[model samples]
Target chain A: MIKVSILGTGNVATHLFKAFSKSDEIEIIQVIGRNKKALLAFAPENKTTSDFSDLKESDVYIIALSDNYIKTVSEQLTIENKLIVHTSGSTPMNELSHHQRHGVFYPLQTFSKSNELDFKKVPICLEAKSKEDLALLKNLANLVSENVYEIHTEQRKSLHLAAVFVNNFTNHLYHLGSEICEENNVPFQILSPLIQETARKIETLSPYEAQTGPARRNDSNTITNQLEQIKKPELKAVYELLSKSIQATYGKEL
Target chain B: MIKVSILGTGNVATHLFKAFSKSDEIEIIQVIGRNKKALLAFAPENKTTSDFSDLKESDVYIIALSDNYIKTVSEQLTIENKLIVHTSGSTPMNELSHHQRHGVFYPLQTFSKSNELDFKKVPICLEAKSKEDLALLKNLANLVSENVYEIHTEQRKSLHLAAVFVNNFTNHLYHLGSEICEENNVPFQILSPLIQETARKIETLSPYEAQTGPARRNDSNTITNQLEQIKKPELKAVYELLSKSIQATYGKEL
Candidate 1:
């Protein structure tokens, strides 16, 4: 069995702990965090400690902390010649360079404390300094997730950036859509199927091929009408900018 | 049984044809379009007509044509006192006022010719002038879909606008994300799970609560880094504008 110790107790860390707990090939050695109360969620099932010095010797130490804390927290680990990895997309794997064997095990999914996710579907992006370390990390990742990739620092950075567009910015657009529905006394749930289909369409068709609506069609009439309907300045600005971008993207084809 | 005749053979028309053909309660009497070649897809199973003068008498006529063509097409129909509804989210119910009985049967989902959709989950927004007409449309909508809403012209207008943000603009963001993935030699599929999860999260949680990433966290370091990595002027502008919008939305809370 591969003994694993998880660092931090945020959403990512909690999720990783739960996923690893389900695997027969994996054993949770310890869960360490600065907050003693946050560590309580994992204490009943496995060892928990706020003190870094009390960390147990494990096959891998997964740091699932926030990006800002990753570098400082990894520095505090006194463990030598052990596999150390952070679950960050943007942060470089070298953030844990204090250790001889360092890598990254970033799960590319948004996590919430309340929502339960099937780890098997989540893509785990892995990176390591050595082939053996990479192989070991791959084994650990494969235990929970079916999708795993060897993503270097540069590629992971771009992936993280791409993720921001698809996840963060996309969610913001959802918020704006919800706002529009509310202003018209329509339930936001009406737009839910469209939202789901938009994401699902990309699985079969490219986003470029899947695109539709007034913006892509360059239907200035509907665009102008919709623009008049949007009262908020910020939302209006976003609508105008994105509509222009879509038109520009498909301008040649039009 | 409800006798229905579809006016256009577009994506919406074809999908509606396939859906109505499966329902025991919905009898698709005729499919009419100016383009004979487009109507061929539905000819063998159902009757097809190119001439509006040859239009079959049906309980309801569904104008599934383009937005601009909706008004003129409805005017062409010689049949009077029949429920003539247009399947348009933006077009007002009054656009079909050329007929004595007019209504709207707008399906709130993105449709593609290549993608086969389960109409059961599709939200069909219904609007009509007379109570009986709306009841008739609801019966037809219920024959195919489980989700139905009574959305008037104003509400449907806002819903259409919201659909553009969540569907059209959101798809554009996916295209941009794919562009980023391609530039870095990372398979765009790696980001698919994240995209799907982003949409799924909003089902249980509001988009405001589900929002994540650098902009939402106000991580200037990562945002600046992402801005620098973006080479294209249009993409850089989008990233900056969207990041600002996100920051503005959550600024008071932060």
Candidate 2:
């Protein structure tokens, strides 16, 4: 079995640790973190360490730390001429180019401390410096997930950008909706289904094809009325910008 | 059981027809459409002609048509004292103020023909001109859903605006992501988990609370690199706008 050392103790680390531990393909050789307190009493018998310098015996080294700290942690590690990978979608795999064999094994799913994730369907994005590293990354990804996609570092950057729009920006909109509800003394829960449905539709239909509403129709009256109704200046600004974009996309004016 | 007639055989109508049929809440009195073929397949006992003049009998009239059409269709109905409601989150209930006793029983869920909606969980937003109408709408919504919320027209409009951001605009971002992948000969499926996870996170955490990425961190190098990496003009524009918004949200600078 391939031996693996996982670094970091946050959401990404915890998620990968639990998922990999359940998998038969990889053995957890060590769980490394700077904080000894984070070295849980329940950690595996095979290995665990508080220092990255202590990790010398492993087939693969997986860095699950934040982007800012990855460079420092990678230098502290002892392993060389072996596969070293990070689990980040935005950070370039080449960020670990200091290592002879570097790659990325980014599970695209959101990780929360309390929530259990479905690894079987979750897409694992793999990127590596060379063909041999790619093969190793793919093999590890394939073991845990049915959806394994090989992405270039440059492409991953674009994908990451798109994800911010889809995820981060989208959630911001949900916040706007909730805020609107709060201002009006209405429960934001009312919009939850609509929010869910919008996402659900994108699974089967293209967003361009699925486009609807006053903005798409260029209903000026409704648009004006809506602008009048929205009290928050920031939300109103967002509404106007999005409405403009929608109009631009459709060749229809708002 | 309450008897209901559905006016309009569009996406909303079709989704509601099947959903209502599955629930033991109400008997569908009739299904009316502009096209004879669309209405022909509906249950004969429950289905009727497209003409509102030929509208036979029902306790409640649910106009599941478009916002542009709701006003026109409401004017078309001959019956006066009917408990009429339209299923639109964006359209104000006062739009039907000309009617004797009008209300909104908007199921604020996004509807797709292929996807089976979990009607029980999706919140049904209720509003009415009269107190009795409010109770009736709430009862009607409660039969099919556990989450019933009373939202005003102003808040619902804002919610609709927010929805356009999260659902429609977000999905558009997905399209952009997929398009960039297709152009670069990379599989778009790589971003699917990220997309799903992005939506899943909001179930527990606030959007602002869950925010993470280059934009939030003010990582200009990565932002510049991503902007240069993207080939499409629209995507570049979206990325720039969203990054600015995120920077603004996080009290960061470009």
Candidate 3:
């Protein structure tokens, strides 16, 4: 059995704790967090602590803290010759290099407090300093997820940036759509199916092939009409920039 | 049973044809298309015609042509005292006002030839010059879809613009993400689950509430790091503009 200790009480940490607890082959040695109250939801009082100096000996120690605190928290862990890992996509794996053995165990998915994520499908990106450490990371990752990759720090950085565009920017567009719907006294629910289908299309077709709009067609009249409809200067600017981008992508003039 | 004749043979037209063909309550009298090659997919040669003047009498005529051709095709139809409707979101219902009766049967969803869409869940937005014409349009809409709304021209205009943002613009973001993944030697499949989850989140939470990322949290360090990682000038511009827009939405400085 692989014994593990999870550090941090954030969404990623809590989710990791729950997934680990469910596996018979994996044992949670402890869950360490500076905020005891946040750790209460993950483990009992006996297996939870706020102290980092008194660390438990485990097969792996996962630091699932925020990006800014990853290096600071890793420096505080004085456990020697242990497989230490942090669950971050943007932060380089070298952040934990202060320890004898360090690696990355990043899950490529957004985690919300209320979301009941199915860990089995989520891709777990692992990176380690040695082949033995890499094998251990992969083995632990396979316990919770079927999708695992030995991603290097450079690739992981690109993945994180791509994620921001697809998830974060896409959500902002939805927000703009909602605002437009509200101003015109239309229910935002009307656009829900369209949003879902747009996501579903990329499963079968490439985004380049699936793309369609007035901007792609270079329909200047519809583009002008749409611009006139948008009242906010920010939204109008976004609309114009994205439209120009799309037109340029298709070798068309705006 | 409501007898209907369909006009055009594009993605929207073909989808409407297939949907209307499935319902026992609706009988498709004839399929009209200027391009005879495209009409073969919908109906046999006897029932499909290129000449709009050869159109047969029906309870209602549905012009599911492109937005630019809605008026041109509607003016060509010689049938009088018939409830004529055009299936377009951006085009106003009055485009068919030259006829005895006119209405809009706008299905608010993206239609593609390859994708099999569930017409039942797709919202059909209806508008007409008279209450009786509106009822006729609603009856035909109800035959294929469960979700129907009585939306006026002004509201439909706003809905179409909102859709451009959520569906078209959102898909463009997916393209950008795919480009990033390719450059990093990462399979775009790694980002697919994240895309699906982002769309699924808005089902329960508002887009504003569901938003999360470096920009939403105002993590300047991570944002700066991401911008530096991006290579191309155009992509860098998109990244900077969208990041700034997202930050501005959450009351943060870029």
Candidate 4:
């Protein structure tokens, strides 16, 4: 069994601990965190410690802390020559440079404490310094998830950026759409199927081939009507900017 | 049984044909389109007509043509006093004013020819000139979908605008994400679970509450890094604008 120590109490760490605990091939060696209250949530099943010096030896130490603390926390680790990694999308794998063997185990999915995610469907992007480390990381990731990729820092950065667009920006649009629905006395539930279908379409058609709307069609009448209907300045600005972007993407004029 | 005729042979029209054809309550009397090749695809099962004059009488006629052609096609419909409706999210119901009984039967979901949508899950927004017409439209809509809302012209307009943001603009973001993945030599499939989860989140959490990323957290360091990493001019502009918008949304400084 691969012994693992998860070094955080946040959503990603909690999730990783739970997932690892369920696996027959993995053993939870310890759960370490700064906050005792947070650490208590996972302490019942495994050894829990707040002191950096109390960390135990494990096959892999996953520093699932926030990006700002990743470097500082890695530098304070007592373990040596073990596979050390961080579960960050944007942070470079080098953040754990203090270790002789380090890698990344970034799960490319948003996590919430309340929402239980199926690790099997979540893609685990791995980056390591050596082929042996890479193979080991792949083995651990494969135990939990079907998708495992060898993503270097640059590629991981690109994925993170793209994620900001697809997840963050798209969620913002949903927020705006919800606002529009509320203002019109319409239930936001009406838009759920549309939202789900939009994501599902990319499974078959590329966004370029799948794009359809007033802006893509250059239907100025509908476009102008939409602009006039939007009251909020921020929302209007977003609608106008995205519309223009869609038009430009399609090689269409304003 | 509700006798209905569908105009246009686009994605919406084709999907509507298949949906109505399956329903025992609805009888598709005729399918009309200008393109013979497209019409041929639907000819084997139904009475297909290329000429507008050949349009037969039905209890309700659905104009599933593009937004630009809604008015032109509705004007050519020789049927009078019959309920004539257009399946467009953006087009105002008055676009079919030429007909005495006119309404909107907008199925508020992205329709693709290859994707067979469960109409029961698709929200069909209805609007009409009168209560009787609205009821008739609702009845026909209920035959196919569980979600049937009496959306007026203004509210439908708002919904349409929101749909643009959530569907068209969101799909564009997915396309951009795929492009980024391709450029980085990362399999785009790695991002699919992330995309699906983002959409699934708003089912329980509002988009405002669900929003997460550099901009939401006001992580200037990561935001700046992302801006620098994006090389494409259009992608960069979108990233910057969206970041500013997101910051503004959370009442944070750029």
lDDT string for model 2 (B14-102, tens) is 87787678877699988888888778657774466767788867878999987888998888888878888998988889878778889
Candidate 1: where are CA atoms >4 Å away? none
Name the candidate that leads on lDDT: 1
| DockQ of each model vs. true complex | 0.92, 0.52, 0.89, 0.83
Better of 2 and 4 by DockQ: 4
lDDT of candidate 4 over A1-254, digit per residue (tens): 88899999999998898888889999889998889889888957459988888888899999999899999989888777899999999998887888889999999999989887888998898999889999999989989988888889989998998899899999988988888888888888899999999998887777889998888887887888788887878778788888888888777433
lDDT of 1 by residue, B1-254 (tens): 99999999899998999999999998889999989889889967458988898888899999999999999988877997789999999999998888889999998899998898889999999999999999999999999999999998999999999999999999999999999999989999999999999999999999999998898889999999989998999999999999999999899995
**Ranking of predictions according to DockQ:** 1, 3, 4, 2
In order, what lDDT does every prediction score?
0.92, 0.76, 0.91, 0.87
Instruction: Give the runs in model 3 whose Cα sits over 4 Å from its true position.
Output: A252-254, B252-254
True contacts kept of each: 0.96, 0.55, 0.87, 0.89
Worst 10 residues of 3 chain B by lDDT: B245-254
CAPRI band of model 1? high
Residue pairs in candidate 2 whose N, alpha carbon or C atoms collide under 3 angstroms = none
TM-score of each: 0.98, 0.89, 0.98, 0.96
